[model samples]
Target: MTAQGLLGAGVQLVLVVAGAPLLVGLMRQVRARLEGRAGAGVGQPWRDVRKLFGKDPVTPRGTSEVFRAAPLVTVATTVAVVAVVPFVSTSTVPEPGADLFVVVALLTAGAVATALAGLDTGTAFGGMGASRAITILALVEPTLLVAVLALSVRVGSTDIADIVSATLADPARVTSPAGVLAAAGLALAIVAETGRLPVDNPSTHLELTMVHEAMVLEYAGPDLALVELASAMRLTVFLGLWSTLFLPWGVATGTGVAELALGAVLIVVKIAVLGAALAAAEVFVAKLRLFRVPELLAGSFLLTVLAVVAALVPA
Candidate 1:
C-alpha cells in the first residue's frame, strides 16, 4: 500500500476504536433519558475504558494463553474490518480487502474468539455463555450471508466496494425490490448481531437473559476493556457497514482529502441517526425467549430468498 493508503487506513482504525465507545455511550444515554432518568454522558464509555486500562487484569487458575489473548484478537479483527468496510471512502484501504465473504469470515472469527475465551475459563457459567453465544451467532450468520449474497447477485460483484459503487452510480438500485428485501433481512441481522433488544440485551445482568455478558463475566481490568471495546467496535462496524452498503448517500467516491472528510462527517450523521432510532425502538420491545430466536432469523432468511429471486427478475 502507498503511504497515503496507510494513513487512510490508520485514520479508519482510530475512528473505529474511538467512535465505538462513543456510539455505545450515546445509545445508553438515549435509552436512559427515554426511560425518564439522568443518563451518563456520551463520554462515559471512554472514561470506563481508561479506568479499566489503569487497573490490573486478572485471569483464573488453569486458564491458557488463548483466554488471555482473546480480547486482543477480537479488537484486532474489528480494526481490520474497519480498514475494509468503506466508512469514509467507497474504496477500501489497501484495495484487496473488499470481499463480502471475507467480511463475514472476520466477523465469525471474532465470535469464535469470544466463545473460545469463555470456554477456556473452565467455569460452568462461562461455558454456558460460550455455548449459547456461539449457537446464536451461528444461526444469525446464514441470514447475514444470504442478505449480502442477494446484494452481490443484484450488482454482480461480491466485492463490497464495487457493489456499493454500482448502487451509488445507479440510484434506482436503492429502490429495487431486491434491495428492499435484502435490507430488511440485513436490518434484522444487525439487531441480532449487536445483541440488542428482542434478541439479546446489552445492559442485562441476568445470567439467564444474557449471552454476550455471560461470556465476558470472567474478564476484569484491561482484558475487560478490550472485550468491551471490541463489543462496541463490533456494533459500530456493523452499523457502518449497514450504512455504507444500504444507505451510502454521502460516502466518499474520490481520493481527494475533501471528499473523504465530508464522507467522515456524513458517516457520523448516518450512524447517529441509526443509533437513535434503534434506541427508541428498543424502548418498546420485549426480549424474545431464546427458543423463539430462530423464528426471527427464519423470517429474515425467507426475505433474503425473495431478494435473491427478485434480483434475477428483469428490471
Candidate 2:
C-alpha cells in the first residue's frame, strides 16, 4: 500500500477511536434534553471511561477466563470493524477479505464472545441476558444481511468499498425507490443492532428490562471501560457505515487530498445528524419487552427482504 493510503487508514482509525466517546455523550445529552432536563456535557462519557479505567478489577468467583478475555475481544472487534469500514469514501484499511460479509462475521464473533462471557459468570441475570441476546442476534443478522444485500444488488457486489464507489460514481442512484427502501430497512436494522430504543436502552439498569446491561453487570475497572468504549465504537462504526453508503455526497471517490478532506467533513456532519436522530428516537420510544423483541426483529426482516427484492427484481 502507498504511504498516503496507510496514513488515510490511520486517520480513520484515530478518528473513530477519539470520536466514539463524544458520540455516546451526545446521544445521552440529546436524550436528556428531549426529556426536559439539563443534559450532561458532551464530555461525560470521557470522564466515565477515565474513572472506570482507574478502578480496580473485580472478578466474580463463578466467572472464568472468558469473562476476563471478553473485554479484549470486544475492544479488538470494535477496532477491527472500524478499520474495515469504508469511512472516507470507498477506501478500506489493509486487511484481507474483510468485505461486508466478513464484517458481519467479525461482528457476530464479538457478540458470541460477549454472550459466552455473560453465561460463564453463571448468574441468573447473566444467563437470561445471554439467552435473550442470542435470540435477538439470531433474528437481527438475517435482517442486516438482507438490508445490505439490497444495496449490493444495485451495486452488484457485497464489498462495502465497491458499493460506496458505485454509489459515488452515480449519485442519482440514491433517489431510486429501491435505494429509499434499503435506507429504511438499514435504519431499522441500525436501531436494532445498536440496542437503541424500541430495541434496547443504553441508559437502563433495571434487571427486568435490561438486555445488554444485564450481561455487563459483573464487569468493573478497566475491563468495564473497555466494554463501554467498545460499545461506543460499535455505534460509531454502524452510523459511519450507514452514512458512507446512503448519504455519501461529500465523501472522496479518488485518492486526492482535497477530496479526502471534504469527505472527512461530510462524514462528521452525517454522523452528528444521525447521532441526534438516534438520541431523539431513544427519548421518544420505550424499550420493548423481552417477548416483543422477536416480533420487532421479524418486521425488520420482512422489510429488508422486500427491499432486496425491490432492488433486484423488475417492477
Candidate 3:
C-alpha cells in the first residue's frame, strides 16, 4: 500500500474508533430531548464502557471458546471493515479489498460470529436470540447485496470506492430513480442489520422482544464491554458506509493533509446529521411486530430489484 493510502486508512480507523460511542450517545440524547427528558450527556456511553472494562471478568458455566472469542471476532471484523472502506478518503489503500462483496462478507462474518456465540450459550434466550438474529441476517444480507448492486450496475464495477468516485463525479446520480430506490433499500437493510428501532430495539431487555440484547445477556464485565463497543462501532460503520455511498461529496479524493482533514470533518458531520434524523424519526414510530419484519425487508428487496432494472434500462 502507498503511504497515502495507509495514512487515509489510519485516519479512518481512528475516526470510527473514537467517534462510534459519541454517535450512539448523540442519537440517545436526541431521542431523550424530543421526549422531554434530560438525557445522559453524549459522553455517557464512554463512561459506561469504561466502567464495564473496570469490572471483573465473568464467563457463564459450560460456555466454550466460542463465547470467549465472539467479542474479539466482532470487533476485529468491524475494524477491518473500517480500515478498508473509504469513509474519509477515496484514496484508500488495497482498493481491491473495498469490493462491495468483500465488505459485505466482513459484515456478515461479524454477524455470524455473534449468532454463533449466542447459540453457544445454550440458554433459552440465547438460542431464541440466535435463531431470530440468523433469520434477520438471511433477509438483510441479500437486500444489502442487491441494493449496492443496483448502484454498481451503472458504474460497471462492484468496488465501493469506484461507486463513490463515480457518484462524486456525477452528482445527479444521487437524485436519479435508481439511486433513490437503492438508497431506500440500503437504509432499511442498515436499520435491520444494526438492530435499530422498528426492527430490533437496542434499549430493550424484554426477552420476548430482544434480538441482539438477548444473545449477550449471559456476558458480563469486559466481555459485555467489548460487545457493546463493537455494536456501537458497527452502527457507526454502517452509517458511514451509507453516507459514503449516497452522499460522497465531502470525501477526500487525494491524500493531501488538508483534504484528509476536511474529509474527516465532513464525514463526522454527515453521520451526526443522519443519526439525529434517524433518532428523531424513531420517536414517532413503534417497533413492528416480529412477524411483520420480513415483509418490511421484502419490500426493501423489491425496491432494490426495481432500482437494478432502472439502472439497466437505456437512458
Candidate 4:
C-alpha cells in the first residue's frame, strides 16, 4: 500500500473509534434540547463506555460460545470496514475488500453474528429481538445494495472509492434525478440499518418496540460496552459513507497531509450535522407500527429501483 493509503486508513480507524460515541452523545444532546430538557454533555457516551469497560464481565449459564463471541465479531467486522472504505480519502489502501459487495457482506456478517447471539441466549426477549432485527435486515440489505448500485451504474464501478472519485470529477451528477432518488433511498436504508427512529428506536428499552436493545439485554459490563460501541460505530460509518458518496466536496483525493487533515475535519462536520438533523427530525415523528415498517422500507426500495432506471435510461 502507498503511504497515503496507509495514512488514510489510519486516520479513518482512529477517527471512527474515537468519534463514534461522541457523535451519539451529540445527537442525544440535540434531541434533549429540542424537547426542552437538559441533556448529558457529548462526553457522556465516552464516560459510559469507559465505566462499562472497567466493570467485570458476565456470562449467563446455558448460553453457547456464540453469545460470548457476538460482540467481538460485530466489532471486528465494523473495524474491518473502517479500514477499507474510503471515508477520509479516496486515496485509500489498494485492496479487494474495498469492493461494494465485500463491504456489504462484512456488514451483513456482523448483523448475522448478533442475531445468532440473540438466539443463543434462549430468552424470549432475545429471540423476539433477533427475529425483528432479521426481518428489518431482510428489507434493508436490498435497498442499500440497489441504492449504491444506482450510483455505481454511472461510474461503471462498484468500488466505493471509484464512485466517489467519479462523482468528484463530475459534480453535476449529484444534482441529477437519479442521484436525488438514490440519496433518499440510501438515507432511509441507513436509518433502518442503524436501528434509528420510525423503523427502530435506539433509545428505546420498551420490550414491545425494542429491536436491537432487546438482543443485548443479557449482556453486561465489557461485552455490553463492545456492543454499544459497535452500534455507535456502525451509525457513524453509514453516515460517513453517505457523506463520502453524496456530499464528497471535502473528501481527500490525494495523500497530502493538508488534504487528509481537511478531509478528516469536513467528514466529522458532515456527520455531526447529519446526526443533529436526524435527531431534530425524530423529535417531530413517532415510531411506526411494526407492520407499517415494511411498508416504509418497501417505499425506499422503490425509490432505489427508480434511481436505477433513471441512471440507465438517457435523459
Candidate 5:
C-alpha cells in the first residue's frame, strides 16, 4: 500500500471510532434545545463512553461465548463500515477494497451479530429487541441496497471512489430525476437504519418504543459501552455514506495531504448538516407505531424503484 492509502485508511477508522461519540452528543444537544430544555454538553457522550470503559463488565450466567463476544464483534463490524464508505477521501483501504455490496453487507452484519447475541442470552427483552430489529432490518436492508443500486446504475460502478470521482467530474449526473428520488429514499433509509425518530427512538429506554435498547438490556459496564459506541459509529457511518455518495464536493480524488485535509473538512460539514436536520425533524415528528414503521420503509422502497427507472431514462 502507498503511504497515502495507509494514512487515509487509518484516518477513516479514527474518525469513525473517535469522532462518532461527538455526533451522538451533538444530536442529543440539538434535540434537547429544540424541546425547550438545556441539554447535556456535546462532550457528554464521550464522558459516558469513558465511564463505561472504566467500569468492569458483567457476563450473564448460562450464556454461551457469543454473548461474551458480541460487543467486540459489533464494534468491529461498525469500524469496518468506515473502510467501505468514503468520509475523508474517495480512496478506499487497499485490502478489503470498497464495493457497494460489501458496504451493505457489513452494515447488516452488525445488526445480525447483535441480534444473535440478544438471543444467546436467553432473555425475553433481548430476544424481543432482536426480533423487532430483524423485522425492521428486513425492510431497511433492501431499501438501502436498492437505493445504492440506483446510484450505481447511473455511474456504472459500485466502488465509492469511482462513483464519487465520476460524479465530481460531471456534476450534472447527480441532478437527474433518479438522483433526486434516490437521495430522498436514502435520507429515509438513513433515519430507519440509524434508529432515529419516526422509526425507533434512540433516547427512549422504554422497551415498548425501543428496538435497539431491548437487545442490549443485558449488557452493562464496558460491554454496554462498546455496544453504545458502535451504535453511535453506525449512525455516523450512515451519515458519511450520505455525504460521500450524494454530496461529495470536496472528497479527495488525489493523494495530496492538503487535498485530503480539505476533504475531511467538507465531509465533516456535510455530516453536521445531516445531524442538525435529523434533530430538527425529530422534534416535529412522532415516532410511528411499530406497525406503521413498515409503511414508511415501503414508501422508501417504492422511491428506490422509481429512482432506478428514472436513471434509465435518457437525459
Candidate 6:
C-alpha cells in the first residue's frame, strides 16, 4: 500500500470507531422525530460511551475469566471487520479473498463471541437473551449466505470486489429482477442482524422484549463500553457492506486521491439515508412477537432463495 492508501485505511479505522456512535445517534434522533418526541442529541451515544469508560467495572460474583475476555474479543472482531469491509469504495482498502462469504463469517465470529459471553454470565436474562439471539442467528445466517451465493452466481465470483466491479461495469445489473429481489432480502437481513425493529429493538431495556440488551445487562464500566461500541461497529459494518455491494455508485477502485474523497462522501450520504429509513421503520412498526420472529426470518430466507432461482432465469 502506498502512503495514501495507508492513510485511507487509517481514516477508515478512526471512522469506524467514531462514526459508529454517530450512526446510532442519527438513528435515535430520526426515530424520535418520527414519533413526535424531541430526540436525544446525536452526541448522546458518545456521552454514554464516555461515562461507561470512566466508571469502574464490578464483576459479578463467580464470573469467570471468559466473561472478562468476551468484550475485548467482540470489539476486536468488529474492528477487524471494518478494515475488511469496503465501506468508502470497493476499490479502496484491503480485503482477504474479497469473498462475501469471508465477510459474513467474520461478522458471525463477533456475534458468537458476544453470545457466548452472554451465556457466561450465568444470569437468567443473559442466558435467555443468548438463546433468543442464537435462534435469530440460525434463521438469518443461511439467508445471508444464500443471498451471497445468488450474487456470486450472477457475477461469476464470490469475491465482493469482483462483484462490485461487475455491477459497476454493467450498471444495468441494478435493474435486474433478481438483483432487486436480493436487495430487498438483504435489507431485511440487515435489520434483523443489526437488532433493528420488527426483529429486536436496540433501544429497548424491557427484559421481556430485549435480546441484545438483555445479554449485556450485567456488564459495567469499560467492559460495557466495549460491548456498546462493538454493537455500534457491527451496525456500521453491515451498513457499509450494504453500501458497497448494492449501491456502490462512487468508490475508489484504485488509490486515486480524488476518487477516495468522493467515495467517502458517497458512503456518508448513503448511510445517512439508510439510518433515516431504519429510524422511520422503528417508529411505525412494533416488534414482532418473539415466536413470530422465526416467521419473519423465514420469509427473508424464501425471498433470497427465490432471488437465487430468479437469477438462474435468462434475462
| Residue-level lDDT tens digits of model 3 in 234-315 | 9999999999999999898888889999999999999999999999989998999999999999999999999999999877
Measured with C-alpha atoms, the lDDT of residue 45 in candidate 6 is: 96
Model 5 scores a TM of 0.97
Check candidate 3 and list the clashing pairs: none
Query: What TM-score does prediction 4 earn?
Result: 0.98
lDDT of each: 0.86, 0.81, 0.92, 0.92, 0.85, 0.84
- What is the TM-score of each predicted model, taking all chains together? 0.97, 0.95, 0.98, 0.98, 0.97, 0.96
Model 2, range 51-165, lDDT digits (tens) per residue?
9999999999977899999989987887887776768745544645247888888887888788888999999989988988888889889988888788888777888777877
Per-residue lDDT of candidate 1, residues 8-75 (tens digit): 55667887788889999999999999999899899999999999999997988899999998999998
Query: For every model in order, what is the number of clashing pairs?
Result: 0, 0, 0, 0, 0, 2
Question: Any idea what lDDT model 3 has?
Answer: 0.92
Which candidate, 4 or 6, has the higher lDDT?
4
State which candidate, 1 or 2, has the greater TM-score: 1
Q: Name the runs in model 4 displaced over 4 angstroms.
A: none
- Provide the lDDT at 96 for model 6: 52
- How much does candidate 1 score in TM-score? 0.97
